[model samples]
Target: MKIVKVFLVLSVLLSITGCSPLVNNNPTKVETSSNGSYKALLFVNGMELQSVGHTANESELVVGEFIGAVNEKVDIEIRPSDELTSNYLEEGTEIYSVEGNTKIVLAKKENGDYEVFE
Candidate 1:
């Protein structure tokens, strides 16, 4: 009887603990513009993630490491690409500029929503 009760309690505890978010060791992927003149750089937990740009119907840049826990923050910086000297006005290129840089900070909430801060 005592062993049965202990087993039930342990099962409940395991289920509760499993409700938390899981950590991802891999980096996040982001879509970019095919003809855009900017690239986005991402930092998570103070580490620069490995990212690459690929060309499909459009261009995409995979950036950032996934946030491992709630309240963890990710920072992104958009800069002008060296391939293009001048900033191009496009859908994804709006974030890039030569006069000033664009940066955003995002924090993961318990509800799985990301709070964005400039």
Candidate 2:
């Protein structure tokens, strides 16, 4: 359930923000629990395929800077959904792909494409 909500929110964000690559020192959200309200601030290390992200309560929100979430470059891509993304590759329907050096947040669209939230 939480995953679904996060995926949806990511989709909306990708549409609004052209999936630009991200860099270190960016403000990312931390974990918190609450009601129906859901949000995500995730970071993926493009070099190591490691990532960190969490949801926050509608009110209790915390902000901090990431030291080195992404190693070198930061970018967001709008690739075809069929393209193998990290975890999604195993299930062929997952929304995230973090197996490679470049870690990216993905949301599966109705058209079978992905909205890469970098």
Candidate 3:
């Protein structure tokens, strides 16, 4: 019985380890926007892709900078509308406008598609 239990545990561990998480797992670097008012970060494969400005906004917001990965680049514009939340890749192009100041992250899947997190 003890051996069977150990085998089950081992099997579960192996399964979990083999499975990949949905987001990138790399370390990220941050850079402030050229205007010096906002910051942005770029993430690659679940890793900290890049860093940008503070995650705060007031009555108005504007597009800051563009987030890129390796050779790929995505437009990181600030939304004037407070309803914007985070950006995501819907069909082909990125859907920049979001709902609110929800923490947003970007990830590229194995299928070569972009995904946005909030």
TM-score of each: 0.26, 0.21, 0.22
CA shift of 1, model 2, Å: 64
| Model 3 lDDT per residue over 7-117, tens place | 999999888877856333432322335676433333333433232322214224333233433333334443211122222222232322224433454334446433443
Query: Which candidate leads in lDDT?
Result: 3
C-alpha RMSD of each candidate structure in angstroms: 16.6, 22.1, 15.3
Pairs that clash in candidate 1:
none
User: What is residue 103's positional error in candidate 2, in angstroms?
Assistant: 3.1
Q: Candidate 3: where is the Cα deviation over 4 Å?
A: 22-24, 28-118
**Which sections of candidate 1 miss by over 4 Å?**
22-40, 43-97, 100-118
Per-residue lDDT of model 1, residues 1-118, tens digit only: 9999999999998997777555322234233457753334433334332223322112222223343332222223233222211122222121211112134333333443333322
The TM-score obtained by model 3 is: 0.22
Model 2 stretches with alpha carbons more than 4 Å out:
1-94
Model 2 TM-score is 0.21
- Top-scoring candidate (TM-score): 1
lDDT of 2 by residue, 1-118 (tens): 9999999999998876765545322433222336542223233332222222322222223322222222222222211121232321222333444234233444344564544444
